[model samples]
Target: MTAREPRLLVVDDQALVRSGIVGLLEAAGLEVMGEASDGFEAIEQARRLRPEVVLMDIRMPGLDGIEATARLMAMPEPPRVLVLTTFDLDEYVYRALQVGASGFLLKDAPPDRLVDAVRTVARGEALLAPALTRRLIERYLAAPAPGVLAAPATELTPREREVWQLIAEGLSNHEIGARLYLSEATVKAHLTRLFVKLDVRDRVQAVVVAYESGLVRPGAQRATH
Candidate 1:
């Protein structure tokens, strides 16, 4: 394994939850930098610790995960947020993505799921399996407001557009490469170009831009996989 294990911050109101998550991550050879009890504290800890990923809870006394996510994202080098909460319903997922959460996972996610989510978020990718709920995307599009994306025109190519659509729909790079009849390396290359063109740092940002900029819509008919 690479020596560069990701640093993680666990944020939840419950002490047991934070402790358990920290144990699991540390066992997986990742660093657990700190833990926070609520969104406000999560923000404070993140500002000080600057971990690579945050395991966030959606609801808390002072600040909710969504609000915390927005605050974290405002930082110049914000950590990737992996929301671990029950707010996976449509509205929350939409808003979470809008505010730049890297992925959503249930608090009850299996051990492997939690590990996978952390790894995915650390690598700047979104997960297909939402941590919070299954119907979140559907709920989000019921009354859609155009999302704000930082991407500009004259950046992405047409093939990159296709890739972006798939990416927003939560396909991994290998899957996208297969769908596009390109190798994973080729897909990564395309993604690199897309990232540079879009001025985004990672896959989460790419997906957000794709959806908010109207490149892909949750209401659209699903394409054949």
Candidate 2:
């Protein structure tokens, strides 16, 4: 049987931008399940439609994308949220990642890139490369922020610590498996253990922890899968 297309919800405050994104996504053969003009509407639509991916714009009025991402992630079987932002350095993008967004896309990203972003997030992978994400986190860390501490990695086993460091290096599960001479399943298991031990919601957060704990450093070699 043919697989179902990924269902998506496009959220942006501007009517023209929302319409354009919806059109582009549909043109790429994705199912545009819904459109939300603001974050509150996004939550309501998400609750009702349960789309596979949410393309969220960050600067919406009342209930910004970061807050909405936090709320949606709290739901049972929440849809993956891919933040849409005008600026890569926008602090809210980092906050969105903290709130459990699967990843992010630039508002002006090309159509093909946008389609790929949606597909990437829908497939349960992060949209941003590890190195880029780490850079963003580094910027966030350089600036003073409350409640941004990385949870300690003291509980991690040595093997788990190795896996965490590799993850911080931006290796994918498959790459980590090959490097460690383990199966992909085993790598995923290691990541799961790290998440539970570190109390992080996703790999992005885990990488953040690695940086905050000094397990990984800026200008270190980044391996992109």
Candidate 3:
């Protein structure tokens, strides 16, 4: 049997851009459940349509994407958010991640990459590239946002901490398993425990907590395979 395509809500202030994104995703055989021009509308549509993934634009006239993302995440059954921005290193993208966005994509990303990102987030995986992840975190860590306190890393066990470190280094669960000589199932089990200890909702949030808590510094050397 064929897998079901992810249902999507495309949110952009610009009509042209929103339409283009909708067309691209629809053409790729994904379902476009609805579209919204701003954050407030996005939230309403999300509540009603209940898409599996949301392609959210970073800027809007009144309610911006970052704030919208936070509101959407606050929902009882929030859809996975894949942020879209014109700039690769935008601080707004980091803010979105802070509020539980699943991942982000450059607006100019290749069509295939964009489609793949939707599927990735839909499957509950983050889509941050290793090098770009490092740069984005390093740039934002200089002045951490208020009320965004660091998670207490002391709560994690030694094994969980090692898994967390690999996650921060942008390793997939499978890759982490291979690197540590553990099974993928074991890696997922570790992730589940660590996520609870860290009070993070997902891997993206876990990575954020790792950097914020100084458990994983922005420029720290990553483990080699």
lDDT of model 3, residue 105:
93
lDDT of 2 by residue, 178-211 (tens): 9999999999998888889898767887877677
User: Which candidate would rank higher by lDDT, 1 or 3?
Assistant: 3
Q: What is the clash count of model 1?
A: 6
Q: How close is candidate 3 to the true structure, as a TM-score?
A: 0.92
lDDT of 1 by residue, 1-225 (tens): 754878889998989878998888888778899999999999999999999999988777889888999999999999998888654464665677668887777777788878888887788776645212224554554433555344473466889878877876767778898888999988999888988888776776676566557666656664444
- Local distance difference test values of all predictions, in order: 0.76, 0.85, 0.88
**What's model 3's overall lDDT?**
0.88
Best by lDDT: 3
Model 1: per-residue Cα lDDT at residue 205: 64
What TM-score does each of the candidates earn? 0.82, 0.86, 0.92
Output the better candidate (2/3) by TM-score: 3
Worst 10 residues of 3 by lDDT: 143-152
By how many angstroms RMSD does model 3 differ from the true structure? 2.9
Candidate 3 residue spans exceeding 4 A from truth = 143-152
In TM-score terms, which candidate is top?
3
lDDT by residue for model 3 (65-141), tens: 99999999899999999999999898888889889898899989999999999999999888787777777888987
Q: Any residue pairs clashing in model 1, and if so which?
A: 88-132, 88-133, 90-136, 104-131, 105-131, 106-131
